[model samples]
Target: MQENKTSFSQRLTLLKQKEVKQTLVGILHGVERESLRINPDGGLAQTPHQAALGSALTHDFITTDFSESLLEFITPPEVSIDKTIGQLTDVHKFVLENIGEERLWSMSMPCFIESDDNIPIANYGSSNVGRMKSLYRVGLKNRYGSMMQAISGVHFNFSLPEAFWQEWLAKLGQEANKDTISAAYFALIRNYRRYCWIIPYLYGASPALCGSFIKGKLTSFEFSKIGKGTYYLPYATSLRMSDLGYTNSAQSGLNICYNQVDTYIDSLRKAISQPSVDYQRFNGKKDGQYQQLNGNVLQIENELYSPIRPKQPTRSLEKPTDALDDRGVNYIEVRALDVNPFSQIGIEANQFYFLDVFLLYCVTKPSEFFDSHLYQETETNLSEVVNRGREPNLHLTHKGESISLVDWALSLFSDLAEVAAELDEANNTNQYSAAVEVEKQKVLDPSLTPSARILKILLENNEDNGSFGLNLADTYKKQLLATDYQFMTADDLTAHAGRSVQKQLLVEQQDMQTFDEFLRSYFESSTELEQV
Candidate 1:
């Protein structure tokens, strides 16, 4: 590890000599924000997606995640992080104006959903693609239950510009090709796995939940009872990332490798194509409705849930893996960020800059192949942090040795400081190092962390996740509604909404194949492979 760190330093010095620091690395950023719509009474909003928000099926920036009540707003990739944030803010303002007495839930956990049946699955129109999207959600609900589907968070999409990659390859005297680029990304993913446990420790905001959420199942852990039904682990960080969040017994056994793009894709491809006997019970349709697409372990590539994923934007009607096979990774999605209840935009500028630094550190440092043993270690480390990150002098295993979590995190911050400084120099701004400094404080003082702050607020309010989150939601709602929409004009957004609706209609009108035939063709075409 010491040698690896030195190697990174040497690479930095070489790049510095080449004046790579002067190049403005295009740090493209976008955000996917998922929030459940809650009624004025703090219960799940039973209404359909508001028409004013545009057609969920065709809108580029706005869509539904798993359920109709869960609104997901996306922003276009922007060189400026503030521009991306501003776009998200504008989308939220637009939705709030049209939602009418409903508020977006501010936290990752759902707000007072009474029953699974009460949760509304997102509806798409008559087109086969739209229908497929809806049916995919149905499969998810049948597998994971509606309660889990209602949980929401923010996903950060990030990528480095082509020029930056080209410059790095030149510095290394390596050819710029898809294979080499993909290998570099896989290296980043490997390092990300090793250090990803730090993410939940810093940004985790879901430390507690309403009593209604758990419903008295799995009462093994000590939980603080604040209200009649609120339950929380005192030292917890992100319960959202814990086993209680997303789990599948069958999928757990699939130890997919991240050592190379081919290995990763082949593993996922097998899972999606392979049928699982566990899901067979729910495979057949009853009463003119399909229970699920098939008894496969995963019906599609999107079903594989991970904290981080290498991604390439797919062409129309293209499978995710197919896109990766054809083109190298376009960006990586950071999916573990809990919606910060304290902020109106769900994430802060400092958090974005810190993520940039963290990701850069991951890519620059040496990475080892991720095997089954390392996979379990990463999983265990994340679980430990999510449950008891704030415990005094907490320890976690690294390279088969136990070490203090705080000590390890502080050490990593030292490396991150260098990366931040270089990034700051390239951008000619102090923002990067300022962001690192803020996160460093969180490592030194856990109470300043989002999870700790959430617990503190809950303790003050009698341990009520629902009421506390709802109040914050309402406050943010007012604040966002009052703010000016700077990135886009109201007319421009409305026109975009109208255009999306027209596009959905066009899709519906142009469909020539039956739903079953369309499904068959899609699966058959996507599963076809070129001879190696």
Candidate 2:
């Protein structure tokens, strides 16, 4: 047997390495312990509902406030069916214009977050799924473009610059001042800077919009009561792709990410054009990635300047994952796909294989800045997935040329299957490949998408007229209520929360807790680095 004698730090570093390819896609919920309600006064109301937890850092029960009633209200009507590219672009514009664009983004990523309220839930990102499905009813099937604007959720890799934060804290004086809402203002600003501004009520209900904090004069309270780092925001990315069927599970999200997220980031970079940090400020890109309008040059502040902060990137090729944050590196975000209610979690063995392979593809493929033209095309894929997926023959732009959706999906699925098989063989886990084949068959078969079934039931909802979201919201609440509340012991928390869920949760939970508090004694209750 191999000698298990690695030192603690070495083991931690190794664990972090194992998590590199995983990307956090927060499994999101609209309502938590306290579900938010939109008061007629344009304020947010946090109902008594709250997500229960034994500690701030771990979760034994996964709960959400998103109600089925809400899901129905958000589902788009089954109209405006456009099938071609030109027609699709028009539909995309229609959705974006109506959606009132302005959203969040990640660094160097070209996606957007359109301003909308209440979208569908449940296996949302699979196969062009979600409340936005009705665009086809109007002959405006600009597939991906429309889906892009109808985003639902977000995931991120949080990087807190402790020293920069300290400087900011000093500037704010850690207390409410005559300037009014200075700390809160800056907190929101920080949230914006880190792409953490997925405001809870941005779509409709917002606690901050109506909470006592809005009325108070900023007493001795810390900003973390709202959340720790970043909160996963709803109405930002969840689009049920499964309903469109035929293996297009990521359409809804891919649309939102590439369309809304990408454009919004570009807009933001333009909005905050002043020099906050040059390219160098972003670490390994330490050389400062831009030139000032006045033609001045820049570079990152020396890493020694903020030893408490994550170490600055050492090489040009360094990734954000190399450094530590409240959460670790890019963690696995299993998109709730191939909604197998039989599994309760909606993911199946084959789906897991596909995920592993798909992740490997994302990592191995050239993710280098894809050109701007590709963004819209990516969005269109969602619509194609939603409306045309099951048709056996579909079209998509591949490497600058249009190709069949069936062909593309099949190819993509096959590649993923291969990767899963390789992973199994390498890990001595053939079961992984078996799972891939199982899911591959399911994808080939036309089945009910989670949203489809939910919407079918949603039509029966009495609250809203035609919204399919109520079902999902109810499901979320039900899941939360059903979650095992027996607080896991410390050991159990360690077992479940090593890196994956933390990455998933952190993407939505950044800027939730302040760095000072995040690094404080309260968080100490979680565990030492070794335990995670």
Candidate 3:
């Protein structure tokens, strides 16, 4: 452990040199936030994706996820965290102003869903690619049920700028090339997997949920009940990230390797191609309508359930793995964040600052290659943190030794503080270190964590999760609607909406092949990379 610490410190010191430090300013960040639209009564909205908001298939910043009511707001990559948050806020403001009589659900978990069928699958219009996109969601619904698909979260996209990569390559005495850069990212991923439990520990907010979420299902958790069918775990942090949410039993045995880009792409490709006995009953089609894209372990690479993923901007009609296979990793997406209910925009600027520091720490630290045992340990640690992170005296395995969660977190914070300081120095602002310090307080006092605060608010008010979330949704909705747009004008959004509709129509008109032909061509093109 001492040797590892020394190596990490040495590398960090090297990166903190003036030449390398200047490049750090260019690190880019973006966010994709998902939220369900709910009616005035707090029930999941049954309306289709708002047409005035723009085509779900062609919009650059707004779209639907699995459900038609599940709105996904995207922000373009920006070097400044404040600008990124501002852009996200502008998008939210535009959406709220357009969608009448509905509020965006404030929590990561869904609102009062009565049954699986109550959730409507997203529709993406008649273009081949668009239809295929909706069908993929159909596949998700058939495989995992719509209740699970209704859950929402935030995805953080991060990439180091080319200037930083150039400096980093020189610092490590490695060639400046795509492969080397990708290899460095994999090392960062390995470290991230080991310590990422701290994210949910600090920011996880779904400690309690409406019982409607699991209405007809049986769960093993010994849950405590609140007003009128709210279920909660007293010490839980993020039940949204637990086995109850966003998990795949079917892919539980998949051993996707992050040791190299090749291994990762190959594993996802195989998963998409491999047949599944469990999904075969769907037969891919029913009553002459396609029920799913295919009867495979995964219909496509996007179906793979993971907390983090290497990502590349895909070309039109290109598969994600194909893009990675062709160009290596461009950035990484962190998908474990629960929506911050307290924030009107579903995320806060300080969270981005803290993540910037933590991710830099992941890259600076020396990482060991993951073997099966180490991977299993990471899984165990994450499971422990998500389920019972706030429990006093909770111990997690660290390199085969049991360490108290608070102790381990404080140790990590010591290292994070150094990285945060370096980031603050690079950016000429104290926000990074301030963010780290704020998170450190949560580590010391679990009651300060978002998850604990959420449960406390619910219990103290004698309210159920549904009522608490509804109140927040209503509050945020009014606040967003009343606020003026900062980054985008209402007229600008309207013009973008008009352009997106035209783009969708052009795509539909340009389609020369039938849906069957399009699917066949897509699969053929996707698998042709196997020959390469």
Candidate 4:
């Protein structure tokens, strides 16, 4: 570990050189924020996705997640974090204006859901790809239950500039190429897996959830009750990322490798190709209707859950892994963030700044190759932080040694502060250092963390999770609606919706093959990675 620290320090010194420092200026980022649309009464809205918001299948900025009520807002990749966030905010403003009486739920957990049957699956229109998209969600509902599928999150997509990669290759006396770039990303992923618990520790906000989410289900957690229908863990951070939410038992045996791109792609390929006995009982179809894309461990590569993923932009009709196999990692998507209820956009600018610094640090640090034992250690650490991050004297394992979470976090921040300072210099702004400082306070005083703040608000008001979230929903709606668009106009957004509707129609018209053929071809194309 001391040797690794020395390597990181040497790399940081190299990055601080004038010639290499300017290469950091173009770091790109994007955001994908998901929220549920709720009625005035705080019940999940049963209405179909609004036509005015455009086709969920074709829209570039707005779409639905699992259920029709679960809206996802996307911003295109931008070099400027401020512009990226501004675009996200503009999209939220447009969505709020167009959704009529429905308010976007503020928390990562869903609002009051009556039952699984009440949550309508998203409809993506009549194209073969569209039907495939909807069917994928159907499979998710069948496998994970609609309640778990209703949970929301914020995905942060990040990538350093090409110039930085070139500089990095030069520093290592290696050729600038896809393999080298991809290897660097995988190394970053390994380090990210080791320390990602910090994300939940600082930003996790789902300490409590409405009881409706787990109405008749059995849970291992010893939850205490709050005001009417709210269940909570007193020191919990993100129950949304816990076993109660996105974390599940189905993929526990995967053991997917992240040490290299080839092994990673191969693992995903095997999962999709391998049939699951439990899922096989569904027989892939039911009474002449397609039950799922297939009865495999994963219907597609996207089904494999992870806190972070190496990504490449997919071509039309191409699978995610195939794109990576063909061109290497284009960026990385951080999937661990819970939707911040306090922000109208579901994320904040300072959070983006902090993520930039953390991700850069992950890349700069020396990462040891992972084995199954080390991988499981990372998993256990993340689970500990997700469930009981704010508990006094909490401990997590690091390099097979148990350490106080606060102590580990403060040590990490010391390194993060250096990376943050370099980023501030490159970007010509102090936001990155400021962001790290703010998060450092959360590490020292757990009460300053988002989860603690949320619990404090709920406990003070004697409010159920649903009631508290609804209040925030109302507040954000008013605030967003009153604020003028920063990066887009009402006319621009309306035109985008109009264009998406037309694109959806065009896709439907262009479909020449049956849905069966389309599904088969999609699976067949996924196998190309194995051949590669």
Q: Which candidate tops lDDT?
A: 4
For residues 305-352, write the lDDT of model 1, one tens digit per residue.
Answer: 788899888768777888899997888999888888778878888889
Candidate 4 structure quality by residue, lDDT tens digits, 1-532: 1113348889988889877789888889999999999999999999999999998888899998888899999999999888998899899999999989999999998888889999999998998888878888788877888999999999999998889989876886667688888988998999999999999999999999999999999999999998988999998999999999997587898879998999998988888888887887765577777777778888778888899999998777667888899999999999999999888888999899999999999988988888888999999999999999999999999888999999999999999999999989988889999999999999888999999999998899898999889989999999999988899998999999999999999999999999889777766665422110
Compare candidates 1 and 4 on TM-score and give the better one: 4
- Name the Cα RMSD for model 2: 21.7
Candidate 2 regions with alpha-carbon error over 4 angstroms: 1-350, 365-369, 386-392, 451-532
Predicted structure 2: lDDT: 0.27
In candidate 2, what are the lDDT values of residues 1-532, reduced to their tens digit? Answer: 1112334233223222323212111111111111122222222222221222111222222212122111111111111111121222222222112212211110100111122123222221111111112212111111112222222222111222233233323332343221222222222222121111111101111101112211223323222222211111111111222221112232222222111222322332232222322222322211432121111011111100100111222222122222222222212222222223222222223433444444444332223223455544544554344333444444656557877655655666565565565455444557657765654554464333332332233234322211122233334334433444232333443443344345435434444554334334322442212101
lDDT of 4 at 303: 83
- Judging by TM-score, tell me the better candidate of 1 and 3: 3
lDDT of each: 0.83, 0.27, 0.88, 0.89
TM-score of each: 0.96, 0.36, 0.97, 0.97
Model 1 steric clash pairs: none
- All models, RMSD in angstroms: 2.9, 21.7, 2.6, 2.5
lDDT of 3 by residue, 1-532 (tens): 1113338868988888998899899999999999999998999999999889998888889988898999999988999888898889999989989889899999999999989899998888998878888777778888888998898999999999888888877887777688888887888888899999999999899999889988878889989999998999999999999989988888877788877888888877888889999998876577888888778888777788888999888777667887887888899999889999889888998899999999989889988777888888888999999999999999999888999999999999999999999899999999999999999999888899999999889889879999888999999989988888888889999999999999999989999999999889877776421100
Candidate 3 residue pairs that clash: none
Worst 10 residues of 1 by lDDT: 523-532
